[model samples]
Target chain A: MSDGARERILAKVRAALADVPRGEEPEDVVVTRGYVRAHTGGELIGLLVDRLTDYRAVVHRVPAAEVAEAVAQALKRRGVRRIVVPPDLPTRWTAASSVVAVADEALAVAELDGVDGVVTGCALAVAETGTIVLDAGVAQGRRAISLVPDYHLCVVRADQVVGDVPDAVALLDPGRPLTWISGPSATSDIELDRVEGVHGPRTLEVVIAE
Target chain B: MSGTFVGMPAFPEAASAATQNAQLRHNLRKATHTIRGKRAAVVSELDDWAELRAAGKAIKDRTLRHLDVYLEQLEEAVTAAGGHVHWAADAAEANAIVTRLVRATGETEVVKVKSMATQEIELNEALAEAGITAYETDLAELIVQLGEDRPSHILVPAIHRNRAEIREIFNRTMAEWGVPAPANLSDEPRALAEAARVHLRDKFLNAKVAVSGANFAVAETGTLVVLESEGNGRMCLTLPETLISVVGIEKLVPTWQDLEVFMQLLPRSSTGERMNPYTSTWTGSTPGDGPGDFHLVLLDNGRTDVLADEVGRQSLRCIRCSACLNICPVYERAGGHAYGSVYPGPIGAILTPQLRGTSSELDASLPYASSLCGACYEVCPVAIDIPEVLVHLRGKVVEGKGTTVERVAMGAAGWVLGDEKRLGLAQRAAGKARGLVPKRHLPGPGAAWTDTRDIPDIPEESFRDWWAGRGRGQQR
Candidate 1:
């Protein structure tokens, strides 16, 4: 089935594009990409905060050494008692949160779902778009940890924040599974009105450690 | 696959009847207007919007022009990454392939991310016939599935249903599906979403097989990207042991770098967000990560026919953002159901006809659904000239109908317009006899045009006569 269908479709496609002049390469059509790579250019951190807040995520900026304190405060403020901590996330970051730190060692789907939240260090953050990209890296863990939990707290280092989508795409390796979170899960499916807090994380708290 | 929309009435018939439903019209107007404002705001945020639009269009055009080459590259890359690639020439074949894959996994039930491709093929119906059930996980999709209704919008399939309607649907239908709605569910948007989340969570957690549709497939790395607002996409893409993604062959991009353009373009154009809540991108299978067994099904299902049309093929550049739908006046009045396909609105008017051909009355009437307002093109992220394609498809439809009165009328108009002298003579004659022309209706075959409304008041005086009176060749 694969062999026959594949050739037939390809032949049809080649036949369909018969209008192209002979020897014309794909690039001959010359795609002019004059779009700017970055849109806003204020203090990147401040812009990131503005964007994250627009999406209704709680954002707190703290000094580099006080990330754990911020994490603890965010959890305490939200009254989350237990959080999924992926491997390689600096223990010091969540050790003092006073919340139960459940290890994400291949946690079951239902188990992860039952946890209070999952907090991980993001691979990168985009300032222009306010997106946190998780590549299932050592610190980020797999895609499930960030998704299944009802609440997600992400730690963003100032160094990990990029300017825009293209900047993040340039730095990312597509082979690894990637999850880009712009806000808490939201939907505008009803009457085209946006309502935050859907299936993903109802509450997304971000700790920006400068 | 084609059974769902087997005998839909022509667009005019359906649209007129649809407009009579004040509730449907209200739902559509509110929803479309809301999205239209948001889209304009986000799209205007960048000074380089036109450039981005051009680049997005160009990328898709190039990929489509050499689709065979890129598809081969994608297959090789996916194969190298431990994923199996399957080619489906049509809907039946794709459904068969997916059913077989699910059967091999021995899973009676599968969770599905909302996919136009799947809906286009009616995959759920096909799977049901084969004794396998596919559960739609997207919130809007869930509402439609439960209501036993067709999707009315691309981004918000249940946009035609208000919160009150959704509450009723859930309360009445949720128990039979899997989990029941909370004993008491309110009509608030938040409550409805929560109900859906709770109801679908069980299915997401325990599903052994998942079916999905890709937003973009990178031929460069074999990475398939799914952009979604809810975690359902992430759940289906990550939790399942066996994952199958059915993608249209036209959904290809030549390289990973191309994703940067589309990623920026799609989110803003769709949902008016800087980025969607969750965008999951993966290349085949990772040892201990996501799905252990990955299968990519490339489907044609009339896409090749669409590609063969030079003028009509621009519809293929659509990323399914539904920006055109949100900005269309025709869509706002008649709603998505009138278009008679998984695709609706201006893009649907052009794309559906080419894909399905103009053999059916519904297909033929689709090309004429729009007023040729060009609003869809202005909002289109990929800059598909939907109006251009609509007129082109209209010509195809007219040509297909051998010696129809409308075709004869258009032919007469064309003949008159071809020679300036004849056109001027006809215009002068019409202007001299303007009082004889009825404002209400024309006699005989022309009555069809005025069945619903009166004809224009003969344009006071011909523009040609006005131009001549103003000294045609001289600068006024």
Candidate 2:
């Protein structure tokens, strides 16, 4: 649109576009983008918490100093004895918990699935739509660590929460493989009825540290 | 509109049979209505919906207007990244490339996400012919695949089948595919979903190759985006060693910022959710995350022909949300199978004919299938003026075909009105034969026309005769 069709397809595309004036830049096409980026008002953290809860994610809020204890309590509440983390993850976070914390050093598909859960810091979160964006940052490992595990415990700082999708998209890097997770895996294939829990994580728990 | 399905029955005939199925109609009504309500609720949450729809439409228009430039840019960007880029002018070329890519890896099976492009190219069938088994991992695609059935709806392929039928399909066919359904499996959505998860988990974990379609491709960064509700997309995308994606040329956006508009619009319009559970975006091959070797096939497959037409080009703006299907009255009654294409509903009616041309009986019937109610246009997120396109395509369908009775009637009327003597003579003849004319139905050729409408009564006395007889008063 390849091989012989590469030039052929491009010629066809150029020919088909005879109606447009030649050399018109894409920016000159006059897109009416009057839509506001953010639709929500008031506090962002509270809104993020509300939206996440609406999506059926277990959300907890605490002061920044209490983040480790909160992480420990989340694992204890789930009765999780083994948790996975990236090497760059803060030691204090897992030091507070009694579970055996394994580092993500190119964990195989089976190894990641066998763990009780995975806890990683997110790149950002959207308040308007309860979403956590992962960018394989220092704390967040490969995309598999968050995906294969049945449970995901993501840590989002208060400053990382954005008001809308555009706000979050603006701050993201296009070069990296980014994953935006709103809640646990779900489906509406059976008669258009939504049922939570599928191949991805069945349970999603988020901790917002202010 | 793939070449594999050119000989389907005309729309009226297929729709007539489909509408007669009471169970199919009930299922369609319930499912379409449920999603329709959900979509409306989510869409109304934002006050700037009209603005967003306009921006989405403008972006697609701008991209399509200079689609050549974007394609070249996207190719360069993707090539600069670690991904291998392949261009296919037709479905056969696409199938050959993907089959060869899989063969190079020495893999016999591949896991797949729910992709409209792959279905349009009939990739699964092509893979099967090459001794490869492609398992559909999406729950809806799974239902359609397990039942040995064709998908009816775009988003939910199994919308026509209820939970009871789904359980039957799973119970009967699961063992043959790979895993067997549990004996205690019930007719609940959750239970059925669990069965699909267990069955496809084996495929996802073990698959060495995976094939997918992109919702959008960023030309600036060489990124490919996939938005899905289930984690199956992540599994096929990340877990595979060799990944191949087939994307239509129209799915490109100029920059990464364009995703913000679609991310907001697509989820609300498709599943009626504030946000779909998962969205995965990757540029080429990530070092240790996704597939080591990534192949991106940019497919035309008759899209350029669609681009050639002025009025028909607007149909390319579709995002495959199936919002039009959920809201369409014709789709509610006739179902998607009647369209005889992977794309169904209002979008299909216009898009199918343009992509495949109106030469076939089924494609010709699509334009006339609409009631021209304009509901599809109002609900469309990209704002494709569907009724206008339907009417426009109807003109194209009738342009060179000169055998219809309406054409003959119009020709006779023109001949009669061309001269004063002919008009006077015809009026006198009609006045004399007025008593013979039936009040409602015209005799031989017009019987079917009067079934729903009445023919106007003929005037007892010709106006010419009355004017001549009235003398001075009438003349003055």
Candidate 3:
């Protein structure tokens, strides 16, 4: 019965576009995808670090072998006592971190909020925008874990960093719930003055592993 | 979409008071200038911004041209993803569908993620009529709601309000809504934000159903994407058990790759960020994450009517970035409240008239609101020629009503200009009577035009006559 509304609306849309040549595929519009896809070259990781820090997200560039130590240092610097981690997160990343790693498996929203912060791995990072994409894959737990806590410490491997938005988007799975976080949640609503730490993490510490 | 703006005076009548409000003018100027500066800096960073803009325009045009096919494909994909898709032909139907969905959850309250679609429908008012209370979680929206004020800007709804006003609103109104402001609440932006955070936290954690609007919806994956600064949107999108997204049919793009273009354009154009703090994308219902039961409401209202227009159709390509609003001189002076709609400024000048038609005084007066400066055209991410549409709608308004006086004047001028002899005779006669013409106001309908402007002094000899006589003098 509700299909009547659907049909009526579609019919209106079709009638509205009756003048547009029919049977043309959307591709026939001949869109000029002529924009430069990437703004940086091999320096994308450094660009990403620079951009992230510009938004006040504490960024750590560490050697690949010291990923665990970096995570531990970030957590300790923020004085995070308890941290939430996804069940599928690689053990070595947080192996040296003394903060109690609360597995997000079957944890309620309230319990997740009780933690001081969340430690997660990212799907990819965008250099131009200083964004970290989390698609609830292995290490990036459910959206709530990253959001509920006051602090978020995320790890981004050098290989996972892309030069621009187009590249980062290509790596993401739209089917999975995705969160592209640029910095700690901030608002410029009042007098257009930026005030950080609204609803998301007040602090975002990105540890960039080379 | 709602009748809140009904019975409102026409644009000139409405703007008269706004133009007089010195404080409003100052506030608007400051806020717009700040955002405009930020936007210009970041936009210049991209070397291929022109190409990016063209692609944005082309992509939207393609999607809108074949919108029916995409909508069908979208429905199928969403259904396949374990989500239910509902359709609404207008605001009332959209409101009813959303109300029903919320009622089904048996929840009296629903948290909202600053949706202009919902605002267009006056969904909160409709929900209130259905005995449901909707809480606006965005900081600007919260201020607007608490102050019982209307939104003035698109991206920052309460851009008109400064820190002092926001602090006052929170202090005065927060107690009425579950949470009270701190006794020593200061006017600092951070302090105000913290108060809002504490006030809205309980609502976010406890809400069973969440209602939202999407920035973009991917047809291929049945994904709804929302970009927001505050985690309020994240909470509304993720914490709730039942999630209902009310989106305009025009908000869809064909594929995930299409998102790549907008993801870059929108952030840079709006709020001047490379990316907002959080951008959440979900395809229907996720098994264990985000909202478990999802519903998508595709709203048309008057969009199909807008889509039908060839010249005016570009308005639909607007991503609600408000770059046009920031750069518009008219909007800077007269302010958004003067537009008297959910949408204001350059986009509003064209979009509102088409969506609502010229039936009402406010709607009819909208087309004339712009100065046709073309600044809006320059900064538009989708490159919507807002001036072109404004002129088109003005023609529609003149055609639809009692424009016999204007028509007669135009007809007389056309006749004189049509023949060289007739124009020469008329010009000579005007030259003879040039000394008799008044410098200030003219009589009858011409008075309105001359009231605030000067009547140009007629030349002693007509330019055409001078040109013709010059050739004879040169021959000698």
- Models 1 onward score TM values of 0.94, 0.95, 0.98
Per-residue alpha-carbon lDDT of model 3 for B1-476, expressed as tens digits?
12366577888888888999988888899999999999999999999899999999999999999999999999999999999999999999999999999988989999999999999999999999989999999999999999988888899888888888888999999999879999999999999999999999999988899999999999988989999999999999999999999999999999999998999899999999888889999998888898899999999999999999999888999999999999999999889988989899999999999998888889989989988889999999999998899999988987856567888998999999999999999999999999899889899888999977999999988888888888888432
Lowest summed-lDDT stretch of 10 residues in model 1 chain B? Answer: B1-10
Root-mean-square deviation per candidate: 3.1, 3.1, 1.7
Best by DockQ: 3
Error of 1 at B114 (Å): 0.2
Candidates 2 and 3, the one with greater DockQ: 3
The collision pairs in model 2 are A2-B87
| Model 3 chain B lDDT-worst window of ten | B1-10
Cα lDDT of all candidates, in order? 0.89, 0.91, 0.91
Instruction: List ranges where model 2 is wrong by over 4 Å.
Output: B1-6, B415-435, B439-441, B451-476
The best candidate by TM-score is: 3
- Clashing pairs in model 1? none
lDDT of 1: 0.89
* Residue A98 accuracy (lDDT) in model 2: 93
